[model samples]
Target: MSATTPLEPAASWYAASANAAPERPPLSGEVSCDVCVVGAGFTGISAALHLAEQGLKVMVLEAACVGYGASGRNGGQIVNSYSRDMDVIEARFGARTAQALGDMAFEGNRIIRDRIADYAIDCDLRDGNLFAACNARQLKGLKEHQALWERYGNTSLELLEGDAYQREVSAEGYTGALVDHSGGHLHPLNLVLGEAAAFESLGGVIFEHSPLVSLEHGSPVVLRTAAGAIRAERVVMAGNAYLHGVLPELEGKSMPCGTQIIATEPLADDVARGLLPNGMAVEDCNYLLDYYRLTRDNRLLFGGGVNYGGEDPADIEALIRPKLLKVFPQLASVRIDYAWSGTFLMTLNRLPQFGVLNDNVYYAQGYSGHGVTCSHLAGRLISEVMRGREGRFDAFANLPHLPFPGGRLLRVPLSAVGAWYYQTRDRLGL
Candidate 1:
C-alpha cells in the first residue's frame, strides 16, 4: 500500500573484491528496440546476450547497478539442479515432466562453462561441489539422490562416506558427502558483470538505475521509467523478488525472503587447504542449509539462515557467525571481514514460474534459492522461445503454480510457519 525505499547494493565481500566495472549512464529519453528487458541481473543479461547474438536489437533496464540484486550477492556456488529435485518433480508433475526437466538439469552448468570460455570472462571458475550430510538419514538421502541423478545421465556424481568424507572436507561433523565433479563455484558478482560486458560487446544497450514505473500492454508494449520510455515489439520481465508493483498478475505467486552470508579475512593457504582439502564448494543437507566455499583469495565465505518476511537482521554477522563456527570450529578466531543480506523469491511449489503474460510479453522468476545456474538456463530458454523453439520453455511454463495462501497480508506468516516445520524436521534428523 505504501512505497518502499529503494535498496542500494550491500557492502559485501563480493562487492569489495569485484573487478572494476565501467559506469553506464541511466536512461534519459525515448528509446525503441526489438526487445526491452527489465532487470539487468543474470537472467536479463543472459537473455539480452543471446537475443543480440541472433541479430536482434535489445536494451536492458536495471533498477540499480548491474548484479546489485541476488545475482551479485549470492553464495557463489554453481549448484546444479532445481530447488525441487528430479524425484519430487516426477512424483508431483509426473514422469513425463520430470524426464523433460532432467534433460536440461545439467545444461545450466554447461552454459556457465561455455560462457566463461567463449567470452573469456574471468570469474574464478572451478570444478567441483560437495553436498555434506549431517546424519545417517541425510547420507542415505544423498545416495538415493546420486542414483536418481545417475538415471538422468549425471554420472559425474561420486558418493563418499566415513574417511572419504573427512578427506574431502576436514569438518568435525558430516557423516558423508556427494561430490559433483561437474558443479563448482565462482565469484558471482564478477560473473554477472562479465556477462553484462559480453552482452554490451554484442551491440546490446543497457541502462542502469532505471526502474520501471509503469507498463501499457498492446501491439507494441510501452514501458516507462521516471525519465525515459521504451516502445518494443516484445518485453522480458526478469526482475524476480526485486520486482515490486510493476505487474499485478505476479503479486501473490511468489514472496520475497532474505538470506545472509559472512566472509572471513583471507585465511592462510594452509588453513584454507585444511578446511576444504580438495577445494570444492560445500552445502550441508538441511532445510536451513549451510553452504560455504573458499574464495580465490582463500577467504572462507559461509552462508545460511533465512528471513521469510524479507526483513534483514539487525546484525547479519551475529546471526551467521554462529552457523559458520558450527561447521568449522577452527574458524572461531577468524575475523569476519564482511557480512550482508540479499533476497530471493520463493513460489508455493518451489519451482520456477515461467510463462507469457500477453502475446508479446514473457516472464521468468521465482527461482527460490537455486538461482545461480537456473537463471542462466532461464535466459537461454526464454531466447529460444522468442526464436520459435518453444518446447523447452513449455516444459517449465506448463507447470502449475498456486498463489501464496492469504494473499499479501498473511503469506509471510504462513510461509514462516511452514519453514519452521521443515526446519524442525531438519533439526530432529527426520
Candidate 2:
C-alpha cells in the first residue's frame, strides 16, 4: 500500500477535532529493530513507546494512521474493569485469580493519565464515569456492582439512588446510577495522537500506511509489507479487530463488531449543564447499552447499538437517534453534527486475550468493547515480558480463551442470536 492510505475515520467527530498531526513516512526499504510492533493504535503505540523509552530500537508498522481503528472511534469513556465485571471473574476464575486481575483492573486508567501529563498531551480529559440503570432490576444490579468493586479495593465507587442521582445526570428513566470517581473520559483520538507523538519523541519510529502483509514468527521474526519488510528480535501483534488475515488463529477466537456513535451540535450553556450536571460520562446497565456524554464544546455525544459481524448499519443516525432522545428528550430539536461507526474485537468470554504466538511473537487483543483502558494495560504487560519480567503478564496470559463454538461461518449468526436473547432480557428487566 502507498504511504497515503485512506483513513476510514475521516468521518468521525474525533477526526474533525483531533490535534494537528504530521503524515509519517512509511517504510520503503528493509529495516530492523529490537522490537517490531504491528498496528499503531493504543496497544501498538503503548508497547512501542514503553520499549523505546527503555533504550530499545522499536519500530511500529501501522496499516493506516495512528488511532485509525478502535483507538480513535470508541465511546471515549475511561471505564475501568474489563468487559466482564470483577464479580463474574471471581465466580468463574476463583477469588485468587480474580484478586490478581482486580488489582490491575484500574492500573490502565493510571497509565493513560501518566501518558497525558508526562507527554504534555492536550487531550481534554474529565474525571468520573457513571453506570446508569434504566429499571429497578438494573438498579439493584448496580448496587451489587458497587459492593463487588468495593470488595476488590476500588475505593472511588459510590451508588446514587433517585434524587441523589439527579445532581449528576438529569436524563429521564433512570432509577439510579453508580459513580466511579476514579474513572473518566477524554477525546480518544487526541489521546492516541498525543501518545503517538510521545512514542516518537523517545526515538521510536512509526510507519503509517504500512500494513504487515505477512509474518514469519521465528528466531528473528520477519514482517513483510507491500513496500518493505522488518526483521526484529521480537514482534508484537496489537491489531485486534483490524489484524484480519495476519493472525489466522484468531479467526474463531474472536469477532469484530461495529458500534454507532453520533455527535450533536453545541447546545445552550444552560441546557448542556442541565443535561449532564456534573459532566460525567454515562452508560446504561444493559447487555446492549447506550453511552453518552457532553463533549468539551457542550455537544452531547451519544453512542449505542452493536452490529455483529462488523457490519455498518445503513443509517448511523437512524439507529442511534432514538436511543439518544430517550435519555434526553429535550434534545429533540438538536442537530447531529457527525455520525460514524467503528469496529472492535469481541471474544467469546468478553475478556482480553494475551499470550505468545510462534515463540517470538507476542499478542494482546480481544478487549471486547473495553479497549480504551485495557489496551494500554496490555501494552505495559507485554513490555514487562520483554524486560525480564513475566509475573504480572502471566496473570492474563494463563487464562483460557475459548473459541466461538460454531465455525467462522456460523459464529456471527450464533453470537447474534445470543446477543438478541440477552438484549431481550434487558428489555424485559429479567
Candidate 3:
C-alpha cells in the first residue's frame, strides 16, 4: 500500500548487456572538495563531469553503485519536450515562459546526443523517436502537436499517417504518429556508466556505497556517511527518490513513481527489421505510455506497466503482456527474457524543480520520466550556476511546483489512488 517501499533490484536487460563498469571504492575517510554531489545517477555524474572539467574540486557520493537509481533503468526514450505537455505549461505559466521551457527541453535532447559523441560513449545511439497515437483523439492531438512544433520552427517533427506508420514501424495499432528527429533512445545504463567514467577521468572523486546519512549546513557544509564524510563549500541533493532526510525542505515536493519494463530475447535481425525497420524508439501518446525500442542485439526492449502502490504485481508479465501484444500482436510469441522497475520522482505539475534553499545548498529534481535528457541539462545548468553564471539555473528555478497533498504519511497513498484512476482511464480510453 505504500509507494515509498523500496523496489527490489529486478533483473534488467541493461545490466546484463552493458560492458563492465570500473568500480570506485566506498568512502572510508573524511574528504574536502569545492562541491559534494549526493547521487550517482545522470545528474550527479554529469554535474561532476562538468564541474571537474571546469577545474573544480568535486566529490560525488553514491548510496549504491553508479546508475543504480532510475538513470540506469528507464525506458531510455530521449523525448523532445518537457514531461508535462506544452499546452499545460502555457496554460499555467503563460506563452513566453512556456516557449522558453520548451526550447530548453529541446536543448536537453541535444545535450544527450552531443555528450555521447563528445565523450565517445558507446550507448547504441538511435536517431529518431515515434509518439504513436492509440486512438482517434490522440491522432488529432498529434496533428495539433505537429502544427505547434512547426510554428515554433521545430521542423524535425513529421506527421506520419496511414501506410507510413505501418511501413515505418510495421505496426497497425496506432491511428497515426509523430516522428521527432530531435529525440531518440540509447542504452541508458551504459550511458550512465560512461558518464561516471568520464567524470573520474577528469579527476573528480566518486565514492560508491557512501550514503550521506546526516548533513550540517554552514560556510562549509558537512555530509556524514557511515564510513566517511565530506566537508565542502557547496552541497547538492541529487538523490531523487532514493533520498530521505538528506534535506528536510525537499521532502514533500514530489512522490516516487514506480515504472516497470520487460525485454524479449533477441529476435532474428530480419524479424526485428520486419517489425521496426527504422530502428527508432516508439511510445504511445497516453497518460501511462508504453515505450519500447530495439536493442542493438535485435531484442524488443519494451517498457510499460506502472505501479503507484509500490507493490509490483505478482504477475508483471501478465499485467504488461496485453499492452505489448496490443502494440505488436505479431510478436506475441516472443519470449520475454527480462523484467525490472525503477523509482523516479514526479511532481504534481511534472516540471523539474531547481533552486538553492540557502546560498550553498542547491538541488534539482521532479523530472518525472524526462530524467534522461533533463538530468544532463541539469548538470550543465548547475555547473554554470556554480561558476557564477546563474541565468540558466534561474530559468528553471522560476517554474512553479506544488508539494504533494498528504506530506510524508499520506502522499504515497494519495499518489497511488490518483495513479490508479489515471491507469484505469488509460485502460478504458478516457
Candidate 4:
C-alpha cells in the first residue's frame, strides 16, 4: 500500500475537530495544467496558491484530505528556522549560503502571517513561541542562539530566567527560556484547510484522494493517479514523508520518521492560565526534544518521542505521556483526549532536500521536523523557480544530501542510535 494510502488520518484531535470543508471529488480522467502539484499539504498548496495567483492553471493532487499529514498533526507551533540553525549552515556551507538562508530564516513566519491576514484564514492564529532550557548547558546555548538570530536581523526575541521564566510556563525544572514574540501557534488543520479554500478562490484546482502512482518526467511531465493522469508543463513534488516511495530518486534521499502527540482534556480557566500564563507554544533544547502548547480551547497539546521508520507506536499515549509529565507533571491527572502519530521526513544533515529530478520535475522534502514555516517558504521559492527564477531556490537546492549512512534496512536503527547519543547527553547534562 502507498504510504499516503491511510483511508483516514489517525484519530488526531485536529481530525475530530477539523473545520468544515467540502469533500472534494477525486481525479477521474486525464487533465492538463500549467503546473501539476503532488500532495495537497502545506508546500503543495502554498506552491499552487502562488502559481495560481500568477494566473497559471495549477492543479493539486492530494493523496488524502488537505492537511492530512504533518501539516495538520504537528504541535502547531510556528517555530522559525530550519532544524539545523543558521549558524550551523554558515559553519558548514560557508557565509554565502548561510547568508542567503539567513535572509529567509523568518520568511516562513511572515508568509504564514500574511496568508492569515490577506486570505482572512481563521485558523485561530496567535503569537509567541518559547524555547526552554532543560539544563544549564542548554540555558547557555539559548544565549548564543539569541546572538546568532540577532546577527540575522530578527529582534523579536526576549530572554527570561528564574522568576520571569517560571511565570511564563508554570512548570518545573526549566532553567530559562527564549521567547520569539513573533512566533506563534494555531489550529494547524484549519490553517491548511483555509489555505486550500484561498487557493481555490484564485482559480486553482484540488483533487482529493488522488495519489500519484507514477511520474513521467519530461518537458511536460505526466503524472498518473490510480484513476487519472495529469500532463503539465511543470510538476512539483511536495509530498514529503507521506509521499513514501512514489519517486525512485527520492527514496534514498531521506528517511521518514514518526512522532506522536496527545492532547489533554480542557482545563478550567484558572488552571489553564496557571499552566501557561501567556499562552506561548514551547519546545525544549534537547537533541530529541519535547514541544507543547495550550490549545485555543485551553487543552494542553504536548508531543515528542521520534519513532524512526514511520511506524506508529503500539501505544501513542504511553510513549508521550511520560515525557509530557516530565515537563508539566501537574498534568499527570489530565485525561488524554486524543493521541496520534504523523511522520516527518528527516534527511541525514537535518537540512531540506530540494532539487530537480528528470529535468522538469522539481521536488522539496525532509523538513526535519521544521515544516510548519519552512514549507511555506519552500513553496514561494519553488514557485519562483517554476516561473523562471532560481536565485533564492538555489540556496536550498544547492545543499547536498547524502543517503542515510546505513542504506534502507539499517537506516532506522542507525538514526535511532544517533538520537540516543544526544538524548543521553541531554539527560546527563554533558
Candidate 5:
C-alpha cells in the first residue's frame, strides 16, 4: 500500500483501447530540476505541462506507467464540479467562498476542452452529460440542483422529464434528467497519453516506474526513489489515493475507495443509439450512483458500486452486471467484454483536499470520484501558486479538511456504516 510499490495497470477496456505511448525510462543517478512532481496521473502531468510551458525545469516521477492509475481507468465523464456540490460549500464556507469555488467548478471542463484542441488529442471527445433521476425525490433534487447552478451563472442546464427523458435515453427506470451541455465524455487513457506528449513537447522530463521512497525537505527539497534521486527547488505531490504510505500527513485525511466498471461486447449501432439517443454520458442521482455511456466502438461502459476500503471485488463483472441489468435488462444476454476496478481518494467532507506541507512543498488530493476534471484544475492552480499567483489556489486551499473520524483501523467500518444509511435511503426511493 505504498506509492513506491510497483503496480501494473489493470486489464481495463481503457488499457485495451489506449493510444500507443513510448515507454519512459526509469530514473537513474541524481538529477536536479526547478520542480519535481510525484505520481504521473492527471494532476502531476497537468502541473508539469503548465510549468514546462512557463519555462520551469520540471521532472515527473511515476510509480507505474503514465495513466496507470484512476486517471486512465475512470468513467471518462467530464463532470464539471466537486464531489461535494456548491450548495454544501455555500452552507459551510459562506456564499462568498462558494461563489469563488463555483466560478472555478466548470473551469476544469474548459481546461480539458482547451487541452484537446490545443494539442489535438485523439481521445474521441464527445459533448453533453446527463444526471438522471431514479425517483420523484431524486427528480426534485435535480430541479433544486439546477436552480443552485443557475444562481452561479450556469445557464447551460436543461431539464428532461417523462417523455423528454425517454427521448434522451431509452433506459426504463429513470424519471427525469438534467443535461449539462458543458460537460462531456472521452477516451480517458488516450487523453492522458496525449497530454503527456504535450508536456514532453514543452521540455518536461518524465520517469516511469520510479516511486518516491523518501523526501528531505529544505530550500531545495530532495526526493529519493529506488534507483535515483531528484533535488528540486519545489515539489508537488499529485498521487491522491495511491500515494499510499509516502506521505503520513495525508494518509489520515483521505480514505481510498474502489469502484468497478464493465464494458459490453460491441452492440449493433442501432442498439447503441437506442440506449443513449443523444449520446450523452449519464449518471443517476443515487448514493452509490450508476454511470454509463457508449464507447466509440459501440460498446456500453457501465460502472458503479464502491468498496470504502479500496478492495477490488473477486468477480467485478458479477458485482456490477446485475446493477447494469437493473437499469437495462436487455443487456442480460450480452457478453461482457471487459471488467476492472480503480481506486479514488475520498475526504471526510467529500471535497478535494489542497494545502502546502511547507512553503516549498504543495499537495492536492481527495477529489473523491470527481478527479477527472478536478485533478486538471488542481494542476492549473498548483502551477499558478508556484508562479506566485495564489488567489485562485487559495480559494481551495483555504477550505478546511477534517481527518476521518475513527483513524485508519476504524475509518473504513465507520464509513461503511454511514454509507449504509444513504444506500438504504436510495433503495427506499427517498
Candidate 6:
C-alpha cells in the first residue's frame, strides 16, 4: 500500500464547530519509557492516561493530530453494547463467558461517564440511546432483547411500542425501539483531545505526527519512526485500521473497513426536538445499520453506510445524504455541512482482538463499529494486564479471531465479495 498521511476530515460540520484542541510537538529525539504506545486515538490515549495515572512512564505516537482517526470521526453515539449479538458470542464462547462479555460491554459505558466526571471534560454529554426496529421481525427481536436485559438486572432499558415509538421519533420507518437510558452521545473529538491533555498533564509524553513505521518485538520492544524511536519494556499497538503492515504477524487477523458520517447544518431547537422528540441517539436494526443523533447545538449528526473496500468514495456527502433523507424527509431541505470517512477494523467474528506477541508486545483492535466505549475498556484491560492482572484481558483473548481466509492479497477481495452478498440480502429484505 502507498504511504498515506491522515486524510483531512471531509467538510464535516463537526470540524467546523468542534472545540479547538491544544497543540503538541512531534517527537524529534529518541526516548525511552516504561511503555510505548502507537496510535493517538481513544484507545492509545486512554491507555496512556491510565498508565500515567499509575505513575508509569508512557509515550504516545500518532500518525496525525490527536483524534484524527475513527475516534473523532465516529457517529458520537455512546452505545452500551458490542457490535455482534449475544447469541453469536455465546455460540463461540460458552454462555457463562458470553454473559461476562456482555457485562463488560456495559462497563465501557460507565468508564466514559466516570472519566468525564473525573476529568471534568466538557463534550456535550447527553443521555439515552434508542435501537429503532424498522419491521416486525426487528421489533420482535428488540422486545426479546429488552426482556433479556431485565433478566440480566439491567433496569435502564425500556421497551417503547408502536404509538410511543412513533411519538418519540419523527420517522415512520421504525415500528418501535429499545430505549437505553445509560447510553448517550457526546462530542467525540473533544473527549479524545481532553483525555490526551489530561494524560499529558500527568507527565505522559505524546508525539503528534509521529507515525510508527516499524516495530521489532523482543525482550525490550523498539518502535521506529521517521524522526525518532522508542525503546520500551512493553509496546502497545493500538493503531486500528491505519495500522497496515506495521506488524506482519497482525496482518491477516484483522481487516480495515471504511465507514462514513455526515453532519447537517444546525436546525432550530424546536425542529431538532421534533426530529428526535426524546433526544435519544437512534440506530436501526440491520447488518448495515444507520445511526443518527441530534447534537446539542441542534445539528443532526448522521452516520450510516459503510465500505468494505479500502478506498474512500469521491462523493461522500452524495452517498450518505439519501440515507439521511430517508430517515427524516423533513431534513431533505437542510444542507449537509460536513462529511468525512475513517478506517475501522473488523475481525471475522466481530469480537475485539487482544493478545501478546511473545509476552512483551501486546495489541488490541478490531472493535468493529463499537469502539467508542470498547476502546476505553480495552485501555483499562490492557493496562491491568500490563500490571500482571490478566483476568479481564483473558476474557476477550480467550475468544478466537481467525485470520481472513484469503491472506494478504486476496483477503480484501474475498471479504468484499461476501460483504457485497450480505449487503444485497439487506437491500432485498431477505
* Candidate No. with top lDDT: 5
Worst 10 residues of 3 by lDDT: 1-10
Runs of candidate 1 exceeding 4 Å displacement: 1-7
Comparing candidate 3 with candidate 4, which one achieves the higher TM-score?
A: 4
True-structure lDDT of candidate 2: 0.89
- As for lDDT, the candidate ahead, 1 or 3, is 1
**What is the TM-score of each predicted model, taking all chains together?**
0.98, 0.97, 0.94, 0.98, 0.98, 0.95
Q: Please provide, for model 6 over 328-424, each residue's C-alpha lDDT reduced to its tens digit, 9 standing for 90 to 100.
A: 8887789887788877888888888988888987888999899999999999998999888998899898888788887767777888787788777
Candidates' C-alpha lDDT: 0.90, 0.89, 0.82, 0.89, 0.91, 0.83
lDDT of predicted model 3: 0.82
Candidate 2 — which residues are off by over 4 angstroms? 1-6
Per-candidate RMSD vs. true structure? 1.4, 1.7, 2.6, 1.2, 1.0, 1.9
Whole-model lDDT, model 4 = 0.89
Q: Write the per-residue lDDT of candidate 2 for residues 221-281, one digit (tens) a residue.
A: 9899889999999999998888877778877799989999999999889999998988999
Query: Candidate 4 — number of clashing residue pairs?
Result: 0
* Per-residue lDDT of 405 in model 4: 80
Number of clashing pairs per prediction, in order: 0, 0, 0, 0, 0, 3
lDDT per residue, candidate 4, 190-288, as tens digits?
A: 999999999999889999988778887786888888898899988888889877667867778799899999999989989999988989899989888
lDDT of 5 by residue, 1-430 (tens): 2445548789999999888899899899999999999988899888899899899999999888899888999999999889988899999989988989999988899899999999999999999999999889999999999998888777899999775888778978788999999899999999999999999998899999887888888979999988889999999998888897777978998898999999999999999998898799999999999999999999999999789989888999999999999989988899998999999999999989888887999999999999999999999999999888999999999988888998989999999998899999998998
CA deviation > 4 Å runs, candidate 6: 1-3, 7-10, 420-430
Clashing pairs in 2: none
Candidate 2: lDDT of 410? 88
Q: Model 4: runs farther than 4 Å from truth?
A: 1-4
In angstroms, what RMSD does candidate 1 have relative to the true structure? 1.4
